[model samples]
Target: MVTIKDIAREADVSPSTVSRVLSNKKDFFNPATAAKVRKIAKKLGYRKNTLAANLVKKKNNIIVVVISSVETNFSDQIIKGIQSEAQGIGYDIMYMYTHTTNEEEHKHILETLISRQISGILFVSVILEKENITLLDAAKIPYIFVSIKPDNEHMVIGSDDQEIGYLATKYLINLGHKIIGLAGVDAYPYAGFSRIKGYQRALDEFGIEANEKYIFYGDYSYNSGSQAIKYYHENFSSLTGIVAASDSCATGILNYAYDHKIKIPEEYSIITIDGTNLCNITRPRLTSVTQNFRKMGSLGVRKLIKLMEGKVNTKNKSIFVPVKIDVRSSTARLTR
Candidate 1:
């Protein structure tokens, strides 16, 4: 275990200088002396004791990311954005998964994070209960919600899901799709419900009657997409276009269509939300309303940093990243 004292002895500089140089606080040190200290430390195979250093300072430059699971395809992009931004600013990222729905288990996770002395937290696609919120508030740690909008007033970073739904639905409607089916959009998480509202709003603007039978509410999963297809086939035979909740759900719909020998575009045009790389790989490709996932992540980190720094006017404000549509082969003008 090489220490700063060992490097200081070899470089003939004081331990304080070595510590400052190694920690990147070198503005007060001579450039050549700082360089020599770094060379000696590198030669001695020195590694930082982050936990000990954080203990001494009573805080850490670590951001904890909490997610239910890495089930969505766009999660990777969001993480990439977070890492890129956090690393650039000399912060470390720690991922924690919340698999249990139990409130006690959720409390344990929050307690563990607080014990770590982390600088802040980012909640990705995981909604915290009121009790958990109270715990976080009591701890006085900064946290920002990402990707999902909660009912309470909190700092959140994500797309306008209602606009996403309206954009996807209206694209098909403009292409002569009057009888559109919506799949895998459940009635929870402000995002889901807002998207449903957006879909209905588009229909009403176009004078098309919104039918409840045309909507399939399901968890945003591949299985949910498959079941939506089956349900629509049996219940709504006049469906000519579909708007999916996510790229994975859209892929599931495509898979069901292939297995059932349903001709895409000729039979039904489809558009999905969450424009991840998966959209390009699907057969015929998918037309998607792309959320700025990476931007959401990067902006969340920036906002969290502000809150951690105790910047005034940073709390209680939510940011909604803009979304756009990427036209592709999966959606076409309805000719039938």
Candidate 2:
């Protein structure tokens, strides 16, 4: 609660003198005077405000982490990793979240972190608007974006979702399910496009005709998954296997199938894109692609810290985390 004014008033010195002493500005203060000032400051429990100190020293050692939605398991793991690594390094973290429709998130983020004390920013699967991204580039603050798609012009850390799509489709194909359905978004922020591309590439390699009707585009939510399934059941009678872009989507398919009296593998099989515990707890465990959430989180934090410290150059800034497909009960050997 003590301000610099209070520290100066108690120390019986001018505010500028106190500033010079605390900042160790040897050009202005003698060793004896600096020592006395330090002694008095310690006695009064006086601490420098990070923002104030950073203005003079030009470094603050604080990081900001922003997520689009913590509503899902994936975002939570990123936060956990960031928080853990940040705590270890003694850096303060300012966390923020944005809504799906909040167009003003950029202004708020800028206002919150533009100070000298804010050394770096980490965006966990959150997209910045065009104007705001331009602002971020101009600000000279070190940053790392996660789960969020890169404009390919900024520093972004995320998984190779295209590979995930490829793996999921290839897995289904290997199991003799040539009629595998693809489900994911078709929008910006890259996950949708990259994942879908992976799926298409896999099918192309196998020389299978990709039925465009079997590919359902959704908003990457549970409800969308359900809707996709309902559409497929009504329209695509030949579909025997499905690959949902996310575990949430996969769960939706599983629930729909369960209530509709469809036998798993006996009738159809399903796979999802994430390896959360939700897979195991389902009526039949879901075979899913694991994106290593904890690693993603930790990597985001570590990258932000390094950029904050100016330890790395940002000329080429792309970090790709790998993915793994966990075989489980939901995806069984497709039966004719």
Candidate 3:
């Protein structure tokens, strides 16, 4: 709780001089004096009252990040990106998680954020409802959606999910596998549905008739992957390849296959989305279409900062980061 007054007294200087030196107002003091004040402040364990300073400035240099409850494998990487960018620009980040899609809860979160006078918001895989949008609009709070694309027009930053699907499916197709199954893809209007469409597009382009039975719709969870394998085993035995919705889902499939004595890459070639570290740790390893999640996070913060600074451009409303495929042992050419 040592204050500027304590440091000033120790340095034998006025409080205002200490304040300017500590705040980096260099025009008022020389480097030597500034260094002396800083040294003394460090010695005395002095801490600045950021809350009081922000109150006087009428703005908080804090950004709130809202994350969905269904945390993905790459979420930590995204947060790392956000933290690196925000820290470089002297802004602090606060995190809040939304465990449910309840509108009342969303409203409460929004109200709490507004009350804190946060500079902006970054949403990670959380879709905003109409009421939540209205509240943000009325409050004039800038927000950028990350990892999930909302239905309406807004600031969004994520990988091209459709391209990811297309790339994954096409990779399997190029390996001479026409019978490919899709696992753990949801029908929700997000990455899952878009990826499904991409899967269909690749199938149509390659003249492979897509069988509805090959599609297993489920959330991108490990359990979903296991259930998908069970469903495919029962209904689509002729499938030679499978595209999973996530790395975790792919791992689940691998585990299930091991338990059921299904040979990987020989009996079933699997390609998963989200090229996270989990892909590398699996037994056979997973080949995956990798999304630039870290780039998405850092770019989202940059875009939100632009919006908060009133530099909004009508043309740059959405940003789609690129996706790439990582070759691994889980996938091989159709050699049956």
- Report, for all candidates in order, the number of backbone clashes: 0, 1, 0
Candidate 1 clashing pairs? none
Deviating ranges (above 4 Å) for candidate 1: 4-38, 99-102, 312-316
lDDT per residue for candidate 1 within 89-108, as digits (tens), equals 87889998874234677799
Q: What is the lDDT of residue 222 in candidate 1?
A: 88
Candidate 3: 10-residue stretch with minimal lDDT? 309-318
Against the hidden reference, what TM-scores do the models get? 0.89, 0.81, 0.90
Candidate 2: regions farther than 4 A off: 1-61, 99-104, 115-117
TM-score of 1: 0.89
Off by over 4 Å in 3: 8-21, 24-37, 100-102, 314-316
Error of 3 at 3 (Å): 2.2
Model with the higher TM-score, candidate 1 or 2? 1
lDDT of 3 by residue, 157-209 (tens): 88878888899999999999999999998878777778988999999999999
Q: Which has the greatest lDDT?
A: 3
| Candidate 3 local distance difference test against the native | 0.87
lDDT (tens digit, per residue) of candidate 2 on 30-149: 787677778878888887787665676766667777777623456767778777777768778878777533559767767657754477788777767677767777887777778755
State, as a TM-score between 0 and 1, how close model 2 is to the true structure: 0.81
- Residue 120 lDDT (model 3): 89
What is the descending TM-score order? Answer: 3, 1, 2
